[model samples]
Target chain A: MEEWTVKVEQSDNKKEKPDTEQLEFGRSFTDHMFVMDYSEPVGWHDARIVPYQPLTIEPSAMAFHYGQSVFEGMKAYHAQNGDIQLFRPDKNLARLNHSNDRLCIPPIDEEFVLKAIKQLVYMDKEWIPKAEGTSLYIRPFIISTEPYLGVAPSHHYKLIVILSPVGAYYKEGINPVKIAVENHYVRAVKGGTGEAKTGGNYASSLKAQEVVGKQGYSQVLWLDGVEKKYIEEVGSMNVFFKINGEVVTPALNGSILSGITRDSVIEMLKYWDIPVSERRISMEELYQAYLDGQLEEAFGTGTAAVISPIGELAWEGKKIHVNEGEIGNVAKRLYDTMSGIQYGKVEDPFGWIVKVKEAAPVK
Target chain B: MEEWTVKVEQSDNKKEKPDTEQLEFGRSFTDHMFVMDYSEPVGWHDARIVPYQPLTIEPSAMAFHYGQSVFEGMKAYHAQNGDIQLFRPDKNLARLNHSNDRLCIPPIDEEFVLKAIKQLVYMDKEWIPKAEGTSLYIRPFIISTEPYLGVAPSHHYKLIVILSPVGAYYKEGINPVKIAVENHYVRAVKGGTGEAKTGGNYASSLKAQEVVGKQGYSQVLWLDGVEKKYIEEVGSMNVFFKINGEVVTPALNGSILSGITRDSVIEMLKYWDIPVSERRISMEELYQAYLDGQLEEAFGTGTAAVISPIGELAWEGKKIHVNEGEIGNVAKRLYDTMSGIQYGKVEDPFGWIVKVKEAAPVK
Candidate 1:
């Protein structure tokens, strides 16, 4: 690996890390940050990990209006032996570039970003939450900053990595979340930036999410745009269901994001001798299986909450309870196994863990 | 309308407005800008028109990532007898607020925004091109500036209005453009941010536009996400076509922007005693109309370019040429009439033109 010097500006106020329970999702931050800029004339340059501070950017930055920004969400976990570990960060690096490509921003070498992130994590190791379900969340993003006022791709960009110490995702306990079937709105489409974790997809989803929030639903299950018939995803997570005792998730359609945790759950479920298949599992099929007593589980997977089981699915003026509002058997098994491996409580079999080294004194 | 404290800053090194024919789109700016900031606790404040300078923004601003931004594009034309005029700027202000409401950003008082824009345009009256086919382009935008990394709305926003002296949109000539019917890529889906003039909708359309450019096409004729059959608007312009002496365009679907120029053209066509209808236009239906030789004219409407006629349509493994690669009659008439009203050369029958006031010293 190419080693880069991390020029640090230590904060004058040496505040200790707060208790894990007191941490908010995105409010608290790690000490240091990583940043690199890309210009048409000059490629990516000025790689640094400095004290986290407000960025002095121009107001006309293209990302502000054109939405020419892409980001990845991944976490570092606290292990039993006081070590920090990352789960398949390579996947996130690849996805970031893929998003950059989709958004027309200049691409960055994935390895370079990964190195920058690993350095920040190591320097801010003390900020990592030590509780059972807490970890330091790392956000890697690239934004266009070209000052020109046009609708074309920006010639300049900024690649930044920031870390925040987040509490357990579901603050109120692991109660199953209820999802409303969104027939009126759609999140992504073929040849769209949906598969790429760009900000536009999330922004476009806010209105529908707001409407569902008023109805007491936790999240939304988006349908296909044209027909409004096919199943897509659960807002920020990839959805899955167990029908006829077999695991099922919507396939890698161009519109849905290929989530990292979604992939891991499938692998873990298969490792435990459970059947798994990636296909276009329709809502009609899930509803039919639920009616026939064949549907045993329904859940969603993403980086924040590893695997969240759905307690109820409401659609078209009707509500359908799944698994009688109890956590499904497969949901629990997959969540435990994945969490165990991530937190270093289980035996390392597939070797998905990558350890971070302590910050060395100026290399 | 509430009067704002205008803080005018004069620039000593102002460049002379380039020759009307030599002006390039979005490459030149005027001497001043209008700006206001919004905070959650305090309403909008410090509304002023200052000298054009690099804006100071926080690096972690939400507009750099979540696409929490929206904008309006209009033009100030230098009419005959040296009177500066704006065409339906009130409509742009209304649309900008609509976009803000969708993105969950605080709405700008339309009258305040209009006054700010009027002050800036009037201050830079010399920048409005005097040539026949050129004008001063106005860009009014708002972006989230809160330096936080959260998924929800931002607490701080900057509302800004900037001006640019722009030449003709189609540099090659007033010739018709060739567009490709994109079968795979989807720009905006049903229930998406297509109707809003937000940054994310434009950002989502860039990749497909890139592909269209690579394939030597001027724009992408987007289709519905699910069926991939219904025709949406062109990348930034609303599309219209003449079939058997009747003008038709896509209806105001939730997934498409209701363009200002398009609305004006519909009104003008009706005023000229020509039939016009806004309805859902399908790709198959358009193709059939072209094959039957009933498609007499094809054009796109937007603020940047009043009406750009379409020469050829490439879809279904074929190229459907319109009227032997020449500008259509309706498109030319619509363009001429609109420009005439804007430039004060025609009778002001519709009363659509609004005159801007001369600048005054700030109190």
Candidate 2:
């Protein structure tokens, strides 16, 4: 006898035409989802495809009391071959486990989650829109659901994979964005959860987002917590700037999230033979260089927005316009090349694509 | 017509009394609990006393995905008048709302939660063991249950209050505990969720706890993230040290949590005519003072353990014994007075007690 059993959920058989135009990024999810449970007695069990519904758990589950949770976001692009494909999901799975170890949540079999994602994507593949820059965004998460609220590791956890149909990241179509250079309020600090793909880092960014949004900025350009001088990632994305025709970004400082899109840009830039450097780039350096006409382009990279070319940076009530308020040559090339590989328009030399099978409507 | 509705669950006839000595800290819950739900159509509704049972939620709830949750802990003590009383619940309510504003969860009416907690305590009054240094612990938590894996705030949330009979915090009773002075890893940081009673800060401390737990310490004596020089807080408590016979604590830096018990100690000490001060005390200064025999005693204060003294501090292969490895005079006086007030053995001068009416046992 097995330790756990899958109680498969019967779908409601409600298939409406998905309206791609009126969609906010993460508000609309696909119909079906995948789930698995982890226990001390049983590592991972009850893997199943289920109709998307609310779950039943104890009120004192560790997730609510202790925040023993981790998550990852990746997009399933509607390829030219009429199939949705995931971009390097294994990287996400590996990072998820890394965060799990940090929170002391049980480790997940990386390959199993990949297999489950494949199944769920096939089940709700219609949710994948075909318009340019549109894709089915996938969210994979693990949470400790143990009932006890002790200040220690939980014994039980749940892992779930959900899909959402999303429109173009730059919904108004690739226009340059303004960012606020935040001197205070570090999103993640050294020796903290900065490197983990956990909820706290995102939660830490909400206040900064509200502040920057009120100032008409797209996001907050985080600075190092120690000195508040060195450049870091934006609220939810990695930042890059074009200096002297060379691509430069803040190196992996153990205090910034390792973005998948950040890695992709570096790879494509190297493939194009463009000079790329990752080092401790400072805010003063970028601002001063922009004043001296050395800073050509600046953009942010993340799962939501592939590459958002920054138009202006608001600092201490002064706006620093980049490239005369226009998208530079480097931002466009990086965005187009990365999106091409993701959408199957260009050859995937790194073989990042994971083919999603066809959708099967419920009976 | 009301802000919240009640779910009145009467206690069962069969109530088994557990051995008070064997009761674990947070594992045993009482018979009844209070809960309220939040939705867009209805702001906050369905508040009531419900049977202590497992809760049902969506696996993709915002609390699980983005850590959009907050919790408060307090104890209900049974007094000599056969009446149950609660400590400064108003403070918990205000702090909860402050946390709610940051997480974007709607704040339920404070009166409703107060009444709900009263009803829960009345129903499960028997679970309040008469043993010394023990009481019925109440955990009030709010979690965003929106059934989607988005990083943004949740539209749906649930506020829940549960009662659990907890044993003595210290096994041998009031004995000083050993701690590790952490030079790395931060509990809270500037402009982060440290000041808010958020789960993210607790989650960030999980790995630190694990690493320090291996080094033969109960908790980490955390330092400031930016500098790792100033003392911040202990695992789940606020630190107070006696320097040259003066009670000193870390100031309300934007980093340390505003603990209710920490406030109570400050007020009580001031009332007792003790030289109380809330200032930024550094670890280096603390160690130097300890060496000079000016550091009389150090104690941690919180809702769980009213006051626990510290015997030793280990850091970077240096082990420093505090107050000659014993509970010092200052720690004893504060712990005795606070515990006396909490247990209703002393005069209630500050009007901190909110008495509860006990329910008759089921026939």
In every candidate, what fraction of the native interface contacts is reproduced?
0.70, 0.67
lDDT (Cα, 0-100) at A305 in candidate 2: 78
Alpha-carbon runs more than 4 Å astray in model 2: A1-17, A357-363, B1-17, B358-363
Error of 2 at B122 (Å): 1.5
lDDT of 1 by residue, B290-341 (tens): 8899999998898887898888899989888998889989999898888889
**lDDT for B229 (candidate 2):** 89
lDDT of candidate 2 at residue A164, scale 0 to 100 = 82
Give the per-residue lDDT digits (tens) of candidate 2, residues A147-196: 88788888988888887888887777688888898976878788888889
Structural similarity to truth (TM-score) of each candidate: 0.94, 0.94
Q: Determine which window of 10 residues in candidate 1 chain A has minimal summed lDDT.
A: A1-10
Q: What is the per-residue lDDT of model 2 for residues B1-363, given as tens digits with 9 covering 90 to 100?
A: 154456686767435767899988788788778888888877887777777878877656677778888888888987766778888988999888988877667776787688778877877888998887788989999988887655666788888898888887766767788899887777878877788888888888988898889978999999998889899898889999988979999999888889998998899888888899988888889888877888888889988888888988886777778788788886787777777777888778998988987534211
TM-score of 2: 0.94
Best by DockQ: 1
TM-score of 1: 0.94
- lDDT string for model 1 (A53-133, tens) is 777665566777688889989999999987789999999999888888888887778776777688788878889888778
